[model samples]
Target: MRRPIEFKLRRRTLLAASAASAVAVGFARRGVAQEATAAARPAGPETSTVTLTINGRERELTLDNRVTLLDALREHLHLTGTKKGCDHGQCGACTCTVNGERVNSCLSLAVMHDGDEVQTIEGIGSPDAMDPMQEAFVEYDGFQCGYCTPGQINSAKSVLEEINAGIPSHVTDDLTAEIAVTDAEIRERMSGNICRCGAYSNILAAITQVAEERS
Candidate 1:
């Protein structure tokens, strides 16, 4: 009355193979559907002209609407000082000023800043005419790799400007009092920037020096 072992083994093998085939077919169909859906998606917009006042100069470019301000500066304008780090606006490597406010250029679209005054590291100063912030960084050895220097300097400049303009930060003690260049203030302001080389002390010193000289 019992079935032969060989026959039972054969049946089991066939069932397993059938189940495997079904799974394979399902996966293949899912992959094809995904591909087709991707193919059906709309394409990015055509090129558009964007006018930017970069570093005090009028410049124009025809670029995709998705191009970020960082790319516009580093690629289109050939200003490579603004290092693209993290690319997600987490790292302050692409920090730059737009209309006198410090912004993460990597997160800002070039098209959105049309006719806006954009300032990058190049616009800040040259070796011969180094900006005070740049010089302070060098004098204090604020950077080791120097990849984040441009953004740090830009952000530092903005930090000082914000302090001078009485823009209170989270660490600012008195909202109604004039912002002072305190360690807490600087650290809070510079928290967005990350120096992988562990150059926080030096950067703080540089910013402090510049702030002291200006004050």
Candidate 2:
């Protein structure tokens, strides 16, 4: 009788120990999950304010960190002249002059160009007073759909500057002498800008006209 009673008491003790172990494990798991949740929480707001000297004017804008320069121009500043073609750097439709250099605006973040100079299509010209490149594009009928015209014009202007500045490209013939604005140089430099309307000839003509006038 005594042995049976002791056996039952030992069984009860084992069962209680098992229950205690399960409770301890559950509490530990809960604590771990809570810690993970806390760690995953954001520490602060992911927004920042930046000032851009756009089109000869200082414009202050507060934008999200992830917002691209293209979006800031189109969405925030309402400068829709810079089109968002591929939203990638491949299309070059969102090309704009940043600090006198043409850059794919879609690939650049707005926060990155704090206090930097930006020139969009609107800044380049208006209906009445058009820049020389804009005039050339219109005169030569350099565009069919005009979707990529803004970027094309922007890039074209920069191409002339690049050549005159003696910036050697792949097709630059003489490295020691002055760089001439040849068809090959213009074509190679403007290769980044794509016109889906197949107006390559017209664009080339427009660029050549501008180059001749400048020379």
Candidate 3:
């Protein structure tokens, strides 16, 4: 009888130990599943659809709400001329004309301007028939790597228009009349666009030539 009692006690202890191990295994699996589910969850909001006129055509695209106008132009529309230097608004590589006004495409969102007209570098001129600014850039050797030329030309064009519209620059002494497009004014207005290759001399020459031609 003592042997039988000892045997039964050992069997019960073994069963208890097995059950505890099984429970531990189940908990471990549950923890792993929870971790996987958390990781698989999406980040930020889902994409949405937006339509806008680009260049001279209307385009529709479904993009993430967080997508910027620059990304939409370059990634979706395949207008890669708008360079992405400094995704923030600091660099003017993503400069484009929105409704006749120059704006940093990187700073704006595609959804913000639903129906606005966007003019990218591609829209400015074609390879065969170049815009005056494009021709001027080539004639004056305004670019080194040609990375910032698009933004530079776009900004310069807008600056000239602004000067014609009687807008004053930071260096303007009097805001009562149309500001003159002097070399200093050009430098001050085009300060946002940076050419890493130190092509300021050539760029200024190109812009000055264009301005003089237009004047």
Tell me how far the alpha carbon of residue 95 in candidate 2 is from the true structure, in angstroms, after superposition: 0.7
lDDT of 2: 0.95
The estimated TM-scores of all candidates read 0.80, 0.84, 0.84
Q: Rank the candidates by TM-score, best first.
A: 2, 3, 1
The superposed Cα distance between candidate 1 and the true structure at residue 75, in angstroms, equals 1.7
Candidate 2: regions farther than 4 A off: 1-32, 43-45
Q: Which candidate has the top score in lDDT?
A: 2
Stretches of model 1 off by over 4 angstroms after superposition? 1-44
Q: Write the per-residue lDDT of candidate 2 for residues 1-215, one digit (tens) a residue.
A: 79999999999999999999999999999999999999998887589999999999999999989999999999999999999999989978999999999999999999999999999999999989999999999999999999999999999999999998999999988899999888999999999999899999999999999999988
Writing each residue's lDDT as its tens digit, candidate 3 over 63-166 gives 88889999999998889999999998887999999999999999998888888899999999988999998998999889999898899999989988988888
- Taken over the whole model, the C-alpha lDDT of each candidate is 0.93, 0.95, 0.91
**For every candidate, C-alpha RMSD to the true structure in Å:** 8.9, 3.1, 3.1
- Could you say which candidate leads in TM-score? 2
Residue 113 accuracy (lDDT) in model 2: 97
